[model samples]
Target: MEEIERIVSGKKGKIDVTPIATIFRNEIKEEVTKGQMKPRIVAFLTTDDAGAIEYAKWTKIACNRDGIEFILKKIERLDLEDAIIDANNDDEVHGIMVYYPVFGGMLDAYLQDVVSPAKDVEGMSTTNRFNLYHNIRFLDEKQTKKCVIPCTPLAMVKIIDHLGIYDKSLPMGEHLKGKNVTIVNRSEIVGRPLAAMLANDGAFVYSVDISGVICFQAGKRQGTIKMTETTVTRDEAIQKSDILILGVPSPKFKIDESLIPEGAVVINFAGCLNVEESVESKTILVPTIGKVTIAMLERNLLRLYQNQMQSRSTSSSSSSAQIDQPQQ
Candidate 1:
């Protein structure tokens, strides 16, 4: 098998995210300084996943010097409802994030319960979802506008922007507009929101579940960019589009040399691939997507947090000033 192309790694070599991260950090710090705000406090509630713990740890570290605090708690009880209600009591905790795969159907409800609309950093709450769906208020005190957007989805958008793929000054959205972009999953966490985000920007987004993938053939080419959130759909989608975005790491899978479209860009967000068979002469497979995505998530979360804080402060000041002045 020939080597596959790795999009994230290749882009990393070309994309200097340090400047972006620095700018983001400075902006947030500036806001905190401007507001004379106290240190931020974060809380995590979720099942015990090493990845989740590590992510929370690093995020905490990043915010440490910047007057942001973080806390992590593993949910032993299956009752997330209680966890959320308890989260409300911690006035210092400005952000609430719930990790994935927490058993039962209570994840959403729990998130909704724990996260005040302003502090929904993960953007999983129903209120935030509704706000995003209606485009009611994209950025709050947060500059992003949308509340409760998934971290990954926001990272994808940021990555695209970093690459100058959709800068408003350049008539952005052509690459995705009306383009037949096919996503292979429908998980609310990823598929649904991302599809809506792309569609709202005018992309012709089509979701192909596991069953819809049976119809995929290696030889048939259809779209300009085919993105997959599951390993099962990567090879098929890679073979059909000029650009491919790969996420998920269920297990290693072989990538036949003939399975790639010539000159295609493949981004392996999974960071886990069968090296022996995945090697393609023309393909590039990135092994650091997991790390980069984590970074991206942290960056986005911070932005969302700052935005909320700023918005709240501005509103409070305005309300206070109005009250002091009385009727006009």
Candidate 2:
């Protein structure tokens, strides 16, 4: 845990996304008070898995705090796809999130594909995934208008920005440009999207799996991410990385303190034992996750509210125009 503290103390200080979340929540409250449409998020859970339940609870707390209504729908595995489709078509629902590890990981694909991109607050839909890969400005753009991004990776970026990893003077999207970032995991939810986002922002990203498969991709938007994979010892990648992100999902996974370069920025996304204690002071650590999720959810809800308000304004204007037209 000492390593965790050191990670927090690096750069400007302990990186906290709470302030970011608070800003969104306050904005949401203001909008609701002004008689704008209220936003609601529905979470579909097919299993009673501990992790999923915990996430559901967190999401509820976040929604409540942000002034958005939270609905939890527990359904059977067979009904998962239909349930997501229903939520997609529901005009009252602004966002949809499906808890994972359902049926021993049986329904992952359906959850990823069935949720509509418009309400996919977790950024699991194919359209959102493609946008994450192709648009570097996704995060900076209005969340309701752009592809919704996965909470964890979005949290990581916010934390890094909070810690001054990038120059504050530059725009948020350009912060990671030209940085060498190494992500030590390859999960579809976290590693893959993160790598794609960073690369899209002009950062040279290296994604490493536990099996020592290192995939290098240029952070450019002109073409497809032509990943060049090669097998190498893990230590080499650690030594070369400027900013290291730990998302490996193994409890026993630990990095050698000596391998971590001095002054490197370390982001612990998996909540696992990835960083050793010896290098705690030498690297900046970003360890919080809950606040980031809260922030992302608030941003998502605010965007939805904005879109709803815009639609209402347009309809109202059209109705007034029709009423003013001279009747024959």
Top TM-score: which candidate number?
Answer: 2
Show the colliding residue pairs in model 2: 7-285, 199-219
State the lDDT of candidate 2 residue by residue for 119-235, as single tens digits: 667766666666666553342233424446777787777666555557556665556666778898887788888887676555677788856655656534453464776665567
Task: Give lDDT tens digits, candidate 1, residues 149-174.
Answer: 66656555555454444436424334
lDDT score, candidate 2, position 140: 21
- Stretches of candidate 2 above 4 Å error? 1-20, 31-35, 104-106, 136-145, 168-174, 214-226, 230-232, 308-328
Cα lDDT for residue 224, candidate 1:
21
Scanning candidate 1 in windows of ten residues, the lowest lDDT window is 319-328
RMSD of each: 8.5, 7.3
RMSD from true fold, candidate 1: 8.5
The models' CA-based lDDT, in order, is 0.49, 0.67
How far off is residue 240 in model 2, in Å? 1.9
TM-score of each: 0.66, 0.80
Residue 193's lDDT within candidate 2 is: 87
